[model samples]
Target: MNKLTTLNDHYALYVDGSCLENRDVSATTPAAWSLVIVTGDNGLGKGSGEILEETWGSVITDSSDSAFIGAEVGSNNTAELTAIAEALRWLLIDGGNRPAIVHTDSQYAGNLATGNWKAKANKQLVAMVQKLWREVGALRELNWSHVRAHRGHRWNERADHLANRCVNNQAPMPLSFWKPGQR
Candidate 1:
């Protein structure tokens, strides 16, 4: 049985979007993103592979951003936004109301989330993410920051792995460990 434990009131999430197909049109390629929750322990949180002290990894099924100019599937931007939205959504539903610091290697994702950048292409998709963040703000404080990619950051590496797993159509390891509300 999973044990009840006191968790940090806040979490740091390293998010990455991976598109290994290297196609000009994302519609023809597979792309994915991941958000790895950072904890005091280097190991997986409490059970199986819980992201934080207690949270599940999210897999986004919708790859297309059909807003403004419809974004093709497997686009790195879409994947990044999807990861961010899923993280906020999960935090909202979990009702932990804990503050979150989101780290993204993509300057666009980080800047846009923090209102430092404007969307010129995927306007609709950006709007949707903005809406989600606003909703998250009602329940928890959210901060956005940028991180250098391929620098050997542990959480970032894990997130990168998760993103690649999605591209390969493989499930994130944590999903096989436990289900939300089960432990």
Candidate 2:
């Protein structure tokens, strides 16, 4: 297993984003960003794993967010940046004081947040996420980690599922653990 993919094992924060516009770029289609966050698991039963939030925003005109998203909101990079911004807001509200890493499959999102890469395409969205990252960092320890997308890792899979749900207009649901004839 690659070291990067093991972020779920070490960090409490994992965020993922999905964009519908990238998938179908039809002129009439709405490009929405679905973001999912996993805080961590406590090694307990049904309530062990806690997902902080599942957020969806229209890249074109998501009233939930400010108008700063600008004209390139339909881009996948913008969607990924939106997810990181949301996660940072949640961490600020959740009062995360300990060290935590934000895992993302989008290299653009991770690098922009971590300052490892400069923003060339989605300047507004990237700046927004970087701003949020700095704000969140002031309140707590934060790290950025990039992972391979579409892998079968536990948290990543769940994050991807939640992100896709927004495009499908489906609400986030709990994972079913019961299996028939498991005994």
Candidate 3:
């Protein structure tokens, strides 16, 4: 069973390898209306018995021009995408009278959001993400981009690191450690 644990907010975060920034939230602070999404990968291989990890991030310009809103983490593309959408829903939708933009590294997610492509095998996921996007989009503009991973974007680099950390921490132990007659 997964026990309750105190999670470090810094665990899946990247800011500048040099400095960490704090994100503050307030009841009246408006959401980030314009944003960018960046993703990172560690080259997981299902074949040849290799498995890698994924990470995600978002950067936004909040109602207060001086504040830049952002978040990043380690996770798979699918999970990361969902997390991004949900974050936007909370920040952009739950907040009143605000519109915003969403950017992403997943062409699959971006294309579906803009009606540029059809859903592939993951119809349920597509539908759910789309629903969230539309919900938030209703309040703001959501434009997406499919940026190449690890091309030296500051936010993308941090997000990638976080994603890799998440996957690395959750990876399954090697079969060599199995005990005799273990199921």
lDDT tens readout by residue for model 3, 1-183: 121132211011111111122234322222211122222311121112111222233322233433222222212334344445544555453465332333344566567645567765335445665776667657654444454555554334434444333333333223345321221
Report lDDT per candidate.
Answer: 0.62, 0.61, 0.37
Least accurate 10 contiguous residues by lDDT in model 1 = 41-50
Counted clashes in each candidate structure = 0, 0, 7
On a 0 to 1 TM-score scale, where does candidate 2 land against the true structure?
Answer: 0.72
Question: Against the true structure, whose lDDT is highest?
Answer: 1
lDDT minimum window of 10 residues, candidate 2: 39-48
lDDT of 3 at 118: 79
Worst window of 10 by summed lDDT in candidate 3: 9-18
Q: TM-score of every model?
A: 0.71, 0.72, 0.47
- Which lDDT tens digits does candidate 1 get at residues 17-88? 777555674455666667677644222323222356322232333455232223345577877876777667
Task: Give candidates' CA RMSD values in order.
Answer: 7.7, 6.1, 17.8
Using alpha carbons, what is the TM-score of model 1? 0.71
**What C-alpha lDDT does candidate 1 achieve relative to the native structure?**
0.62
lDDT of 2 by residue, 75-138 (tens): 5666677777767777777774755677678887798877779987767667777788888878
